[model samples]
Target: MKLLSTPTRRIVAISFFCMLAFQATYFVGVIGCATYTLGADAAGVSALVFLLNVVLVAGNLASGPLIDSAGPRRTLLAVCAATSVLGLAVWLAPVSYPGLVAAAMALGFSFGMSTTAIDAYPRYFSEDAGELARMNSLNQVATGASVVVGPALAGWVTTWAPVQCVFAILALAPLPAVALVWATREELTAARGEGAGCGAGAPGAGGEAPTQDAVPGLFVEGDATPAPDGRAGVRGFLSDAAEGVRLVFGRSELRVLFFIGFLGFFVYGAFDSLESLFYRDVLRVGADWMGWLSAASGVGVVVGSLLVLRIPKQRLSTRLLAAILALVGVGSMIYTGTPIVAVAAVGQVICGIGFGALAPVRTTLTQQRCEPGNVGRVSSVMRMGMNSAGTLPLLVSPALAAAFGPQAVLFGASTLAALIGLAFALRGDE
Candidate 1:
C-alpha cells in the first residue's frame, strides 16, 4: 500500500527513529541509573542533563552552517551514525562516573545535531507552506508517539533484561535512520544545488532572487560566489555564526519568534524537570499513574497534530500561534492550580495538544520567513534560542521548586507564557 509518499515515508521514518532514540536515551540516562541502582542519583542526574544541554546549544550553533555547507541529508546521516555509535558505547562501557559522562557528551552532541539537521531535511521534498506544515505535523506526530512509548519501552526492558540490553536496543534505533538517509543521497545532492535548476536568472524556491537586504545571516543564500579556498576555516565559522546571530536579532519578526520559542522551551524544561517531584510529592501518583500522566501530553500532541490537516491552509497565521500559545498557558495554569492528580492530568493533555498544534505552525512560519538558502542557519538559531532557554531553567527548576514550591514556579511559567502570547497577538506583524 502506497498510503504515504516516498519523501513522506522517508521523513517520517527518520523522524520516528530519531525521536525514539532520543527519548529512549534520555529516560534511560535519567531513570535507568536510579531504578537499577547503577550509581547516578538525583544530584548526578543534573550533571548529565546539564552536559546534554550545553552540548545541544553548541551543536545547534555549529549545525546551521554545517547543514548549509554539507547539505541536510549528509548531516542527518552523520548524526544518526554518531548517535547509534554513542548508544552502543553507553551500553558497552562500564557504568562508571567517567563512562557515563563521556556517553553524555557524545549522546548530547549527536542528538543536538540530529535535531538541527532533521528540521532542514523536509525542504528537500517540498517548499510549499501547506506541504511543509503537513510534513512538520507528521514529524511532530512521530515525536509524540515516541514520547508516549519510549519511556514505557525502556522501563519494560530495564525490568526484564539488563540495562545494557536496553541501551543496545536503543542504539539500533538510529541504524534505520542512517540507512533511510543514505538512500536519499541523490535527492540531497539535487537540493544542495537548487539554484542551478532555476536556470541563470529564475527566482528561487523563496519566490524571488535571494538578496542581501531583509536578510543578514551567517551565510548569504543566493550568492553564486564560491567560498574562498573552498572551505570556511575556524575563523570563518565563528564569523558566520556571529552574522547569523545578527541577522536573527536585526529582524523584528525573527526576534519575536525567537522570544516566543525561548519562553516555550523554558516553560517546558522547567515543568519537565519538576515533573516527577510534582507527581510524587504533590499528587501522590504511583509509578504506573506517572507513566499515564506523562503519556497524556503525548496523546494530546497526536490528537492536536491531526487537526492541522483539517484547518484551512490559509487560516494558519500569526493569530493561530497566539491561540495555541494562550491555550498552552491556560493548560499549564490549570495543571498547576490543583493538587488533584486527575486535574493535573487533564492540564497535561491540554498543554500537549496546544504545543503540538504550535509546532507545525512555528516551523512553517520560520521556513516561510527565512530565505531558502539560509533556512538551515535560521532554524539553527531558533533551536539555539529554545535550547539555551531550557538549560538555565532546567538547572534552576529543582531549586526553585524547593524554595517557591512546584505549583508556584509552574504558575509563574504559565503566566510568562500567557504574557508572551498576548504580546504576539496584540502586536500583530510589524
Candidate 2:
C-alpha cells in the first residue's frame, strides 16, 4: 500500500537507467575488443571508432528536433527499440567490417541519440535548476552503476553462452523502458500539450505551463507543446534542422560553450584513454582489478555530480570548472610519479571528480544559451564538440605516451588541465 501512494512517477528516470544498463555492456565490449579484435589493426579500430562518432554527431543533431516535435516519450521509445534490435544484429551477424560498419551506424544512431532528449526531461516535470542538476546526476549515477553492472553481466554471459547470447541479453534493455513509458504517459502528454499550447509564431514563448519546482534539476523553458502534428517522416526534420543550425550559431554564448566543451574534455581524453594500460602494465595490476580501477574513477563522477547538485548553477559552474582543471592536472601528475596501486586510485578519483563535475556545467550552459527553435540543433552542435574532443585523444594519446614515456603523459595531462583552468579563472566573471 505504501508503494501505491500517489507520487510523481519518475518514468523518464527509470527509462534512462534501463537504457544505460544496456549501453554499458555494449560500450565495454566495444572498447575491450578495440585492442584485441583490431589487433595489429588497432590503428584501423581507432579510425572506426572515429567513424562511429560521425554517426553519433548526426544522430545527436537529429534527436533534438525529434524530441521537440514528437516529444521525448515517443522519440525515446522508438530509439530504444531500434537500439535493442541492432544490438541483436551485431550479435547474430558477426560479419565483415563493412557489415560491422553498417551495424555501428545503426547502433550509434539509435543508442546514442537518446542522450540530449533525455537530458531535457527535467523541464517537462521539474523547474528547480538544482533539481535538474540532480536529475542529470541521477543519470550519471545510473551510468556508473550500469558501468559496474553491464560489464559484469557481459562477463557472465560470455562464458556460459555464445557471444550472440550477449545480444539477446542486451535485448532486455528496452523492457524496462516499456514500463517507464506506460506509467508516465499522461504526464508527458500534459507537457506536450503545454508546449504546443504556445502558438508557432512565438519565439521564446514556450508552453506557458510552469515546470514542477519540487525536483532538484534545472528549469526547462522549451518543452512546450508537441511539434505540429501530422506528416512525421523526414520532411519537417530537414526544414527544422536547417533552421535549428542557423539559430544556434547565431548566438554568441553557444559558441563559447562549444569551445569550453572541446578544450575541457579534450584534455580528459588524453588521460582516460591511456590510464587502464598504465595501470595494468606499469603499475602491475591485473584484469580482475580493472573494474575496481574504473569504478574508482566513476566514484569521482558521482561525488562531482552530487556536488553540482549543491552548488548554485551559474554562480559556481565557472569557478568549479576552473578549479577542477588544476585538481585534475595536479592529481594526474601524481599518478605518474607514484605509480603505486593505492596512489593511482587517488589520482583516478580526482580525475573522475573533474570529469563528473564538469559535465553538467558544459551541458547546462549550452542549453541555457539555446534559442527556443534551436534547442535541438544547438544540442547536437555542442555534442559535435564533445565528439571531436573525445575522438582525437585516442589516436594522439598512444603516440604521446610512446614519444615521452608514461611520466610525460601524466605531466602532459596535468599541463593541459592547468592551462585550461588558468584560462577560465583569468576570464574574470564573464
Candidate 3:
C-alpha cells in the first residue's frame, strides 16, 4: 500500500515476526512453561505476573524517551537482542523461584520496549491521517496473525517437545527481525529528520497551507516546535515526554480515550493472566486447545480490523468508543461466564473483534488529534496507562481467585468491565 514506503513496510514485516515470536514465547515459552515447571497455583502465578507487570510498567515509562532519543532502529535492535537473550536465560537458568522471577523481569522489560518502539516507529513514515490509519490497521493485521498462530504453535511445541525447547526456539526467532531492522537503520534515521519538516515546511496539495489540525505526519502548525536536528539528548527526551503527557491530559478526547483504554486493557490483562489456569482447572481444556481458543480471538480481531475499512469516515467521538466498549463488555461476559469451551471460544472471538476495531480507531484518533511533535509521547502515555492499569489486576487477581474462586473472580471482573463499557456507551458523545 502507498501508505507504507519500502522501509516502513520492512518495519511492519519485522514487527509481525517479532510479535509472532513474542506471543509464542510469552504465552507458551514463558507463562505456560512456568506453569508447568512451577505449578499453576494462584500464589505462584500471581507473584510471577506481578513481577512481570512491575518491570513492564517501568519499561513503558522509559520507552518513549528511549525511542525519541535512541531512534526506532536502535531501540528495535536493543529490544530484540535483549529479548532473545532473556528467552535463552529463561531456558538455561535454574528453574527455581528466584531464577524464574528474574527471567520474567528481563522478558517483561524487553517486551515493553518492543511494543513502544513498534507503535511509534510507523509515525515517521505516514504522510497523512488516512495513511496513518491504514498503516496502523495493517500493523494490527500482522499482530493479529501472530496472535492467531503463536499460541497454537507454542502450545503444540511445548506440549510435545521439552518445555525448554520452546524457549530455545524463541531465542532464535528474533535474529531475523534484528537483522532486517538493522538493514533499514540508515533509512529509518533519515526519516526521523525528514519527519521534522513534515508539517512545518510542507503546504498541503494545491498550495494551501495546512491547518493546525489538518496536516499529516508528526509536526503540525502550532504544535510544539519539532525536535532539534540530530539525536535527542537525555534532557530533550524528558522535556518531550513531559510535554507529551501534558498534551494527552490537556485534551478532553485524549483523556477520555485513555481512561476507557485503561479499563479495557485491565480486563484483558486479568483475563489473559488467568486464562490458562481457568481453562485447566475449571474447563478441563488442555494446552493445545487453549492455544486454539486464543487463535479464535485472533481471527476475530483480524476480521474486525478489516471491517473498519467499510465504515464511513466521520469525526471520532465518545459514542463510537462507547459502542465498541459495550460490545467488548458483552463478549467478555460470554467468555467468562461459559464453562463450555466452544461457547467461551465464541466469546473470545467477539471480544477480539471489538478490540480489533477499537485499536486502530483509537490509535488513528490519537494521531490525528496530536501535534506532530508530541505523537510519540502521547501514544506512549496512553499505552503506559493501559499497561499500568494492568498491574493491579496482576497482583490482586490471584488473591481474588483464591478467595472467591477463579470463575467467580473472572465473571465479576468481566461484568464490571461490561457495565463500564455500556455505561460509557449510554453517555452521549461530549
Please give the TM-score that candidate 3 achieves against the real structure: 0.76
Residue range 57-95, candidate 3, lDDT tens digits: 678778988887777779999888887887777777666
Cα deviation of 253, candidate 1, in Å: 6.9
lDDT of 2 by residue, 309-415 (tens): 78776475544556666666666666555758888778778877877777776777666666666677878777766767877877776676667765567667677
For candidate 1, what is the lDDT? Answer: 0.71
**What's the true lDDT of residue 198 in model 3?**
45
Clashes in predicted model 3: 2
Better candidate number, 1 or 3, judged by lDDT = 3
lDDT of 1 at 128: 67
Q: Write the per-residue lDDT of candidate 1 for residues 154-224, one digit (tens) a residue.
A: 65665556655566755899998888887665353553354434654335543555443322221235654
State the displacement of the C-alpha of residue 213, model 2, in Å, after optimal TM-score superposition: 20
Off by over 4 Å in 1: 1-8, 31-44, 60-82, 92-98, 116-141, 155-168, 178-258, 283-291, 308-320, 336-341, 362-384, 405-407, 419-430
Candidate 1 backbone overlaps, count: 0
lDDT of 3: 0.75
**Residue clash pairs of candidate 1:** none
Q: Rank the candidates by lDDT, best first.
A: 3, 1, 2
